[model samples]
Target: MTAHDTATAARVRALVAEELPRLVGIRRDLHMHPEIGYEEYRTSQVVVRELSDAGVAYAAGLAGGTGVLAHLPGEGARAVALRADMDALPIVERSGREWASRTPGRMHACGHDGHTAILIGTARVLARLAAERTLPHPITLVFQPAEEGGGGGKRMVDEGALDGRHFGPPVDRAFALHGWPDLPLGEVGTRRGAMMAASDRFEVHVSGTGAHAAWPHRSADPVVCAAAIVTALQSIVARNVDPLDAAVVSVTVMQAGEAMNVIPDRALLRGTYRSLSEETRSMLERRMTEVAEGVARAHGCTARCECIRGYPVTVNDDGAVAQFEQVARATLGDARVRTIAAPVMGGEDFAFFGPHASACYWALGLARPGIGCPALHAPDFDFADEALPTGVELMCRLALA
Candidate 1:
């Protein structure tokens, strides 16, 4: 690194160290009071308060009344945007931490608490740099709501969160990060192509005649038909989709008979399908409906399939990925950056930013050596406090890049 660059990196680190204490407090506060999608009122307040204290400009009460957009002005023509999700999952906290979620059936199991804290730190540090006039371009801060299936990222883009309507300039490129449990702490990872799968949900309703459990010939059992439909649905991935391609069809919810002895007149089946490519996604939807209907007909029942499209495939722009690698290595050191081996099957609403700007989403490592962390969305999962400084430093340097 050049002398100027080295000095700048050092300054950023020192600033992060200065801010860590308060940021950690804010993160713990968020963890203790978790909120679900479109309901992050308290979390939204924390973000706005932090931005206000830093003298950063922002707009609140957005994206279903919980989104916040903060900005920093610069000399560049178009702004660069950074984002963090502000929603928690619906799982009960079982992490056993002293600061575990106080609200029952809600927790920040996805490390969104950490992401929000890092972005807050980034805003604070960069606001200081902007005061010193060291900024290279306009920076956008997007605190989005409802990332856990509420389409808050899409809502933010639709509401002009990145278009500079409330900020410095129209955003040209965007970046986001998620805390990853598999990678060792202090590392950051990304790839040039697809980073996450496109998620789609399905519900199947099967209609059949009700009958007594003891009378086999007296009824057309809907439960049996629903089970058959579920079994045949698996073939959509195993037999229909190409082995080279990746697809998932899971029947997660099933409801039919309530009584032990009586067969219900109808059955309901709900599940999700995920694919990495649009072609595969389209095919999965088509074949899923076809399989359910085809299987139900042969079982003396009628079926209706409803497919709901969720988040699109998260694709990383080549140029954005390159810039992320460069800035991450420069800020965190060369060995701390990793090129991920493959795209994960999970879904991310951050994919919503792809159409508006050159967007890149990466992973922040959170696991300790020889001790694996809890999987995301698990009851025991919690954000790693020790990794906060690394996340903050990367985001701060990315803003200056």
Candidate 2:
């Protein structure tokens, strides 16, 4: 890097250092009082206060729910959207921190608290730049709710969250970030395409005649059929899908008779399937149904399988990936920025934004050396506070870029 780039990074780092403490406090406060998807009234209020205090113009009651939309208007017509998810998970807190979840059976295990705080800090930074007339373009902040499998991102898009109606010209591009437990603190990771997988859920029911244990050929045992079907479903991934591609077919739930000797007339199975490619997703769905039904029919039992589609694969724009690499490397230094080696199987609601605009959802490393961080969604998981400043600086730079 040149002297000018180094100087600019230093200035941004200093600004982030000044605001880090306050942002950490806010993150902890949000962590303490966690709210779940689509029910983020209190979380929305906190976001409004933060944006309002930053002197940014915003519109609340958006997305047909508790989502807030705000923008830092500047002289330039070009615009970009920066999103931060505001909902927590349903898991109870066992992190044992002083700022652990106060709401019973609800916790910010996914580090959304950190994401919200970082965006707030970014808004503050951009607001300062706007006053000085140095801001290159308008920045729209999307404080989205219900990202935890509630289709909140889609709702915001449908409700004109990025329509740029009252904020500015429609957003030309969009960006979001998620905290990653695999990378060490102070580093960031991104990939070109298929950064995350698509999610689809299925429920299978097998029906047969109930009978006593003494009956051999007198009854069709659905319990045996269900067991066989579960084993058969695994072949959809192992045999049907290409070995080069990735897919997951997991049978997570099974229900059958209550008694040991009496065979129940019905048996139920439920699970989720995930894939990065659309063809693979469709293939898995079709094969799973065929396998379940065929296996049951072989056992003289009837089967019904229902599949519900969820989020699509989160694909990153090639141009956006290149732009983000430049911004991240320049702001955080080359040693701190890394390219993601592979796509993760986990699903994200942010996938909805890809079709609407050029989008890239990157990962902020939250783990520490020699002191491993808890994996996301784990009972004892907590957002790493040390990574807050990095997140703030990254978001601020990306918006200006």
Candidate 3:
């Protein structure tokens, strides 16, 4: 690296250290006051206030009224987009932290608060660099809502978040980060191909004849049939999908009857299926429907399988991944930058931005397992505040890279 580059990085590190405390405070405030997808009014306001304070221009009230896009201009049209979801989960907080969610039945279980604070901190650092005329490219900060299950990234893309229509220059590449409980603190990692699976939900309804509890031969029990279908759904992934390929068919919710004494006329099953490729995704959907209906027919009951497609597979661009690794290795030592071996099964709506721009989603190390840090979506999971400086400095470096 050039002497000037080394000096600039030193400045960024110092700036990150300076911003850590305020960023942690922002993250905690967001955690305490949480909002669900498409309803991040207060979260959006916080982003707007921070950008305004930094003298950065932005366009707000986007994507069903809770998305914010901020810009830090540079010389050319080339730009890099940094994204952070602003929505919280419906789960109640159980993390015992002082800043636990104040809103009932709502919490930042997936570390979006940390992500937002990191981006806000990145914007702050970039703003300082831009003022000193040392930053390279224009930056677009995307504070999107509804990433849990709401496809907020798709909403942002549709509304021209990267098209330069609303604000900033047309985006050339996009990057997003998530706090990963699996990785040790101070490390970061991502894969080259698919980073996250495509998320889709399904509901299987079985209908049969109701009968009195006293009679064994009087009931066409849909409950029994639903049980068999659940067992059969696993075989689709086990026996049908290629052994080298990955797919999941989970029956997470099941409802039979209200009373134990009488057999009900109907039963309901609901859950999600995920895949890393479109071809595998289509095959899973098709086979699931066929299996559910065929199994129900064998049981002399009618069945309906409804599938709701969510986000697509999150694929990383080769160039973007390489750039990220290079910059990250320089910022953090080579030992801190890792190449993930496989794609994770979790789904991220950030996959929506892949087709529109060269996008790469990465994992920020939070804490080790068996520690206080819990898996995402769990009520006990809280974002590690100590990782703020690392996240902030890396994001700033990626944008300037």
The parts of candidate 2 lying over 4 Å away from their true place are: 1-11
Compare candidates 1 and 3 on TM-score and give the better one.
1
lDDT of 3 at 313: 98
| Clashes per model (N, Cα, C within 3 A) | 0, 0, 0
Model 3 scores a C-alpha lDDT of 0.92
Instruction: Kindly give the stretch of ten consecutive residues in candidate 3 with the minimal lDDT sum.
Output: 366-375
lDDT of 1 by residue, 302-339 (tens): 89999999999999999999999999987778999999
The CA lDDT of each predicted structure is 0.92, 0.89, 0.92
Candidate 1 lDDT score at position 391: 91
What TM-score does structure 1 among the candidates reach? 0.96
Error of 1 at 54 (Å): 0.7
- lDDT value, residue 257 of candidate 2: 90
Question: Taking the tens digit of each residue's C-alpha lDDT, what string does model 3 give over 1-401?
Answer: 99989989999998889878889999999999999999999999999999899888899989999999999887677789999999999998999999999999999999999999999999988998888875678888999999998899999999999999876679989999999888888999988989999999999999988898777478888998999999999999999899998999999999998887898889999999999999999999999999999999998898999999998999999999999999999999999998988998889999999998999999999985557468999999999998888899999999988
Instruction: Count steric clashes of candidate 3.
Output: 0
